[model samples]
Target chain A: MVRLSLAMILCLLMVTSGCGKAPSESSSKIKSQDPASVQNKGTIGFSALTLTNPFFKVIADNMQEEAAKHGYELIVLSAERDVKKQADHVDEFLVKGVSAIILNPCDSNGIGPAIKKANDKGVPVFTNDIKYDGDEGKVVCHVATDNYQGGKLAGEAMVKLLGDSGGKVAILHFPQAESCQLRVKGFHEIVNAHNGKTKNAKIEVVATLDGGGVRDEGFKGTKDVIESNPDLAAIFAINDPSALGARAALEAAGKADQVTIIAFDGQQIGKQAILEGKILCDPIQFPDQIGKVTIEQIIKYFNGDDVKTEILIPSKLHYKEDAEKDPLLKG
Target chain B: MIFMLLLLVILFSVLTVKQQHPTGANAGDQVGKTILAQYGKGARVLVVTRDTEEDRGFAQAAIDRLKAAGADVLGQVNGSAIDARKTIESILAEGQTIDAIAANDVTAKWTVYDRFPSVGSAKCVTPKPYMWPNFLKLSNLMSVANQTAIYAIIAIGMTMVIITAGIDLSVGSLVALASVSSAIFIRDYCGGTEASVTMVVLGAFVGIGICAAAGAFNGLMVTAFQIPPFIVTLGMMMMASGLSFRLAEGRSIPELPSAFFWLGRGQTFGLPNPVLLMIVLYLLAHFVMSRMVFGRYIYSIGGNEEAARLSGVPVKRVLLAVYMICGALAGLGGIMLTSQLSAGDPKFGLMYELEVIAAVVVGGTSLMGGQGKIFGTLIGAFIIAVIKNGMNLTDVDPFNQKIVLGAVLTAAVLIDRLKRHA
Candidate 1:
């Protein structure tokens, strides 16, 4: 038995050691490129919350374009919605000696230590889309949509669609996200304000279900809401995925035309739904613009220009009429 | 097993070919240029990825795109984020400018910060502490331990089934059913002003009873009809999953009472309640499997069913009892998981059976019959959890992590075979 155990340990050591050698040997073979022959532009590292969300991907694409235009290299990393991975990505950026780090935090509070580390290293960390709940000085600037304003826009669109005589409405919400919460608050405040002033047009929110900002959860939440409130007039979804899911649920329930759906995050699917007349309108946050402005701010910081601490990009309301006309709304 | 490994390699390589080599021949340069335009001109780009064929294809595609855009393309390196950092360091040591790096997001994140000198204006990403301020490390350890404990609880029951020369594929589904049923019962019946700890305990018992009954049914069918355990458990698995969905009505049951939540999320003596429960269960299982007559009978039956029967062992009743115990454990795991999430999600415990079985097999438990230890299964459960947590901490891509885990599992079994031969 002892001999067998020793032999097994030996085999295990051999396999691990063999696996370790291949990477190091390949790394050794890498020769430096001739500096005299090639132009050396600066590199910028960007850590996105997730590329699975087309919204974040669009922002990343825009950042890449802006970086290229400025004769700079942009390295993009996806955090896949993991706070720890995002923290690690920031560390990688610090190691690469990149000029600046652009962060899209998966969790605002969870990214504090990582941002603090970047601050300690003297690396300027810029936030995009989502703000980090860390030391204020640690993050140089935050570029994101005015989510509350977007939600108010959604509210106004719903009111306009319903006219003076407002009916029952349901909300598919993601309460966990700060941005989503702001959106919901803005929406509720607007509708309540409208209701207080105008007695004839009363917009009563009949059901509010947690959609969790995903297709499956949104579908389930919407289905349950529909089962309880059959006479629901309109549904406001926090994001495109939830809106699409709500649309699916409505169609499955055979109440497709009965409810007017308004959504946020004017993604391609949401725009398609608008054009198809399934959804009334969508508040479009310009992810590409957010990305472009983020890089521009980094360049400003590099050029010794004073940068703004907070930049709010306004969201545009896109209805069916604007789907084909507006470049941003077009898929 | 070798053939399976070869097939996976070939399949991944084929997938790599499809992803790398675009079908549009005439528009290749146009497409490449468009893709490369995002990175801009005069940037020296390095691509780092795993040594797998798939990653190689991605690297090659990136190189082709960068070259078409008139950028100085640094050669591709095959390794993890740390190795990529080393390669970048080597290049930098020779005074080459690294303008940009292109790799999968996870790898790029790790490689981008290699040897970042802390200039007056520069910052550093803090290295996570391992030993000091033991609280942080302990918390992380506890999180991983808690996860392992849940899997270990289920796997302990699976170990019993495997020892008796049987398998229970329905454990995962049973977990979902138990979670959903208990949550629904607690919320609908035992909820509101009259809610009490007794009610919560009763709800748990009812849920566990349902699971035990389902397990008893599986055992009876296996013994009475002389059907294979695999087929019977497979059927039960589907049936239970469907029932869970039907009962849940496709929505998660939330807002369980605090007492119920304590069973999953509470802590005792600085350890998670689930972990404490897991340790206690392991002790009980150890006693049952090692010190009891039932445990011996299980081993005897697994060693040779015909001989055990000839020796007057009641094989059918033991098999029946074994499955019931497995079911009850699965129910316990379900309740714990549901409590942890603070909801009874119909989607809970998805594909958990495969993980449980893998843990059992990796713990040196022979599938052919008995010959396993409860302590070994506990170790196996921790091994899987640690690997998962380590990979997440290291920023390994989720896709590549799967490959690494599979390789580790295969290597473990291969080493076991080698040891046996020796």
Candidate 2:
């Protein structure tokens, strides 16, 4: 009975609080700008699934710098590796009436409702780095590096580094992302191709580890591979961070120079390593270009033009010498 | 001794887990970079003893000097010297690398490892401490206190149930369901109008009370039907989870009306309403446990069920009420969570059951039943929250945070066990 009474009181508080006050005529305070009078010149919001990763931070900075040239406000909000929080940020943008949104989804599926809401409200939305797997027609446009092609490049690079006698190669992949899966698939396509081409050095995939898309996991997974197979001739990492982590582990095991390491998404660290000849090769994806193109697509959507739903950005292979000289590959 | 041994085993497992980094220099550098980004660039943080009063301004001045040079600075103090020691030890243990240490008090003890830059050894006379934003500081404190309160309310009921030699795992799920249901009713049905206020309150209570009935169902199954508490609550846990998912309609319901939001989000006399509600619930539970005839019966049943039955105590009815109380408190926690999030995602309370149980067990509540206190669980809950929040502020690796939490949980249980033997 006491519990019931307290529950009743709590309910009463909630009800009274809801009725506490109306929005003080603020709804009428700012009259809606006419569609003809709408001048799109203000802060541009970048909402990421998570800003915890260094890759995302780089993307955000590039976008922020580019947006500054147009006198645009760049509000970067990190979802702290949470899909719900990312969704919340989307809602916040809609309420705040942002000019445009650039999203890096935590999960392709979870952002569906939020993306739909923004589209219905006539807010142009663009996605970069990661593409949604759901109906591609729903989002305005997506700009991302071909993860599958990059993975195949890494695989081909590894096979070449291993020479004619294909030795054991380990694959470290992120389990949740389709992009990561595609990278592994591409790598296998190349590695399997080399199996028929190479005689003595046939690349054998000894083990595959799920790195969970974290550097620490990559390090641990690399160690696990080494421990399980001491003669791992090469390692194909899903991304640059994981490749670096794997290299760190290999260095610890005193086999850094012996095993050729290859990574995707040629991030700064990966580029630096490539310049220093630490990695065999890393595929360079212009994240900044992806960001810029995403905004351009959003703008096109806002202009009432039928925008192409898909935008695939090709990746270039970054060897030690190429990354050393190319300033674009530096970051 | 056994409890200590178990704690030692857990600690050893965590510490000896094959470290991937050989030199650990690179990992340490990465961790430092992460810390710098999280806190800010070139941040000089001072972890001090709680006993040091704010009047000692030298350290504050030193921190200020560092900050003026484009460095971010932060300081932390806990309840006591022992706590300070534990906090530092946990940080070092998790960090696995120390760049520097600065101290004056007992410098002779740990100064040997202070190979990094040492600021000073002289103790300051007056410490002009920094102040946090009123809202943020209050919110942090309230979060800890509110978390404790929720655990306390549930612990009181749990203690009662245990005293009657009973247990309830279904409480966590029931809490989630009740909170979600009440939030929906308030936001959707009531819609924050003056006339709907009474109805909203009634809706919340009715929602929670129905959950209590679910607990009563568990009690009835356990006592009347002669099933064990473990089996009964476990099954109810699944049932409650299914019910919540069905109610949420497979999507998060957000932007709850201000009235519903106020229930959990508002502040009363500078304390979060949830914290206040927890306190009120605690007082009522304390009264029911300490003063009521049913409370006596619960204790009697725990002391010896057969004897209590022979002694004319209504063991079954008391057990029923005890489980009902546990369910009701969980409902309250769920409601607060709903209010805080201003949304119901069916998945909001995932893995919460483990944390709640950890708090209860660490608080001295016996898994075997018939031993614990509401107050103990309250402290345990606060400790967990502090450790988590501190880890976040200190920029501990997410993986290391998990390891540290597991260690602390083990240590708490060990401490509880020692007290029991003593």
Strongest candidate by TM-score: 1
Model 1 chain B: weakest 10-residue lDDT segment is: B119-128
The residue-by-residue lDDT of candidate 1 on A122-194, one tens digit each, is 4578999898764423788899999999989988887787758789999999876789999988889888888
By summed lDDT, the worst window of 10 consecutive residues in model 1 chain A runs over: A31-40
**Best candidate according to DockQ:** 1
Could you tell me every candidate's TM-score relative to the true structure? 0.52, 0.47
In model 1, the Cα lDDT at residue B115 comes to 43
Error of 2 at B78 (Å): 61
**lDDT of candidates 1 onward, in order:** 0.72, 0.61
Taking chain B only, the TM-score of every model is 0.68, 0.64
Real contacts retained, model 1: 0.00
Q: Write the per-residue lDDT of candidate 1 for residues B1-422, one digit (tens) a residue.
A: 22322333332222212111111222323333543555467767666555545455666666676686688866567754345556666877778866555544323334134344411111111111121221124445576677677789999989999988899999999998998998888888997224699998988887888899999999999988989999999999999999998998865676476687798768899898989999999999899899999999998888899999999999999999999989988888888877765567666777778889888876777777867888778877766665555443333444555666676577656655765677
Q: How accurate is candidate 1 locally (lDDT)?
A: 0.72
Candidate 2: list runs displaced more than 4 Å.
A1-43, A68-72, A135-137, A326-331, B1-422
Q: List CA RMSD, all candidates.
A: 15.5, 21.8
lDDT score of residue A131 within candidate 2? 77
Sorted into a CAPRI-style docking class, model 1 comes out as: incorrect
The worst-scoring run of ten residues by lDDT in candidate 2 chain A lies at A20-29
